[model samples]
Target: MNVTLPPTRSLLVAGALGLAVLAAAAGGWYWYDAQQRRVAAAYAEVMTRVYAVQSPQAPADARARAQQELEQILARHPSATPVGEAAFELGNLRYAARQWAPARAAYEIALARAHSPTVRALARTSIGYAWEAERDWGKAIEAYQAVGREVGPKDFLFDEVQFALARVQELGGQPAAAITTYQRLLKDAPNSVRVEEAKQQLMRLGARAQK
Candidate 1:
């Protein structure tokens, strides 16, 4: 004899399957949520340590603690977003100490982990500053130029990157290029903070600033 489940039994089976699926989805979401929270927490902790090192009023111990914490972040979260942040902070600390080479290395790490062009441009600029600190003018110009070449015109960093690139060109023995860059910036962004500096630099370079 053939047997079939009643309508009630069939409905119960379907409902159970639906509830199981819902539970599974809930569990998966919870796991993702927890992972995101962990990443956020790590970023926050790293920022705290970095700020401590950045603060001039912070004691020597604060610097030491910050270094230790940064190392831990790098060691543990090798691929997390905050690893880039930690590296960036470490670069700032080293730059403050005038340790040019190490600062460049840290900035490079930051560049590797940067998720956006804005962050990449900023890291490149910092690398240029490190090169300038070391008196490596050619590399400084290269770094700054890379930012201009890679970043979009719509980016907020565009003008600042150009200003930095121009400064590096001047320092790299390309005074004429630097003057041209400054003039362009003046014409394009009259309201920029760099405008006054550009005018001053143009005057120093014996170039007439446009009215």
Candidate 2:
């Protein structure tokens, strides 16, 4: 299967003041904006490295290069608009490295920097997964619960987050809570792909879901 990678993020400041009159009046501003775009261009290199690391054709050095590039982007663009993306990428890299604690930390940074609800929720999901990987069930539950509070049922990631929340509950030694979560998904998102998954989990737990 062909895998797709995240596209490059652009500098949010409008394109260079190409007009001569505006440029002359705002020479310093234009120079700063140009520098900003130059810095933002580093995200493209990070994207390339990310794709390489995630690809089946990935080299042995791909991960090392990706980690370095992501760190560079963070260092070089501390106030860059795509700092959130860089942090999220770092979280993904740490998760892939199996450094769950650092992964959660990076995701927390991403969440703090994220302006969009979807981005924040996605960061929370990653945080939950990182906690789950560490077998820190209570923390995972808290992170996943934050997702539920952040996003609505119809949100693009709602079903996925709910399913993960239930699994965290189950693995966290709270089968009853897991069962309730599963039932809620079944009732609220009956047409969701996770519906059958929830049912299967309920059955495995030897509990009947309240349909």
Candidate 3:
């Protein structure tokens, strides 16, 4: 008679197979999570390094290298959390280079994808500046107004948006409106450094302060 394997042996073999499958799945998940973290960390580090180089004389090659690295990271991990921040940084670089159109596009993309309200506000401000660079006073006013409303009256950025909006109003042939906005900003932001500037602008607009 031929010997046969015990039923318990087959049960043990099945259990081992199930355990192996679970282990493989766990390992794959861990690897994927680790990869995502690595990508995010790399992106943050690159952005920090790029921002740290403050000299106007900083080599163009360095900036180009940083951009290339950021591009590669973004290409590899399109959905990374830092991608929006990277786009914002790139927009700043382009803006500093006076590349208004591309800077505006990049800032728009960053604003659309930004997860943080602070970052979105910054992108909005930058977009307003880009419009100003292009001398599109109407668009600049719109952008500044949007940013001002979003940032609220108590925020530090309030003064900046107010100033930008006033300038846009002046350029849009609404000097009276500009004077009114400046006067309001001066009253609201009495301690702000821009208060004096606002007063000067009001004077130039022939707007006398009410007694």
Top of the candidates by TM-score: 3
Candidate 3 lowest-lDDT run of ten: 202-211
| lDDT (Cα, tens digit) per residue for candidate 3, span 52-128 | 65368878777777666766776777788887888888787778778898888888978988898888899999999
Cα displacement (angstroms), candidate 2, residue 44, comes to 2.0
* Decreasing TM-score order of the candidates: 3, 2, 1
As for TM-score, the candidate ahead, 1 or 2, is 2
Q: Which candidate would rank higher by TM-score, 2 or 3? A: 3
Per residue, candidate 1 scores C-alpha lDDT tens digits across 1-211 of 9798679989999999999999999999999889878977987977876785677887867776776677677777787766776788878777877789988888999899877656666788899999888888899888888877776545677678778878778778888899888887788677777678889888988743243
Q: In lDDT terms, which candidate is top? A: 3
Sorted on lDDT, highest at the top, how do the candidates line up? 3, 2, 1
Question: RMSDs, each prediction?
Answer: 5.0, 15.1, 5.0
Which ranges of candidate 1 are over 4 A from the true structure? Answer: 1-40, 150-156, 207-211
Off by over 4 Å in 2: 1-25, 207-211
CA lDDT of 78 in candidate 1? 81
Question: TM-score of each candidate?
Answer: 0.73, 0.81, 0.83
RMSD of 1: 5.0
Cα lDDT of model 2 by residue, 1-211, tens digit: 9987544443222234346557686988888999888877878767776866876466747786787788877886788887787788889887888889888888888999977666777898999999899888898899889888877778888888888888888877888998898898888888887778788888977744343
Q: Please count the clashing residue pairs in each candidate, in the order shown.
A: 0, 0, 0
Where is the poorest 10-residue window by lDDT in model 1? 202-211
C-alpha lDDT of residue 77 in model 2: 77
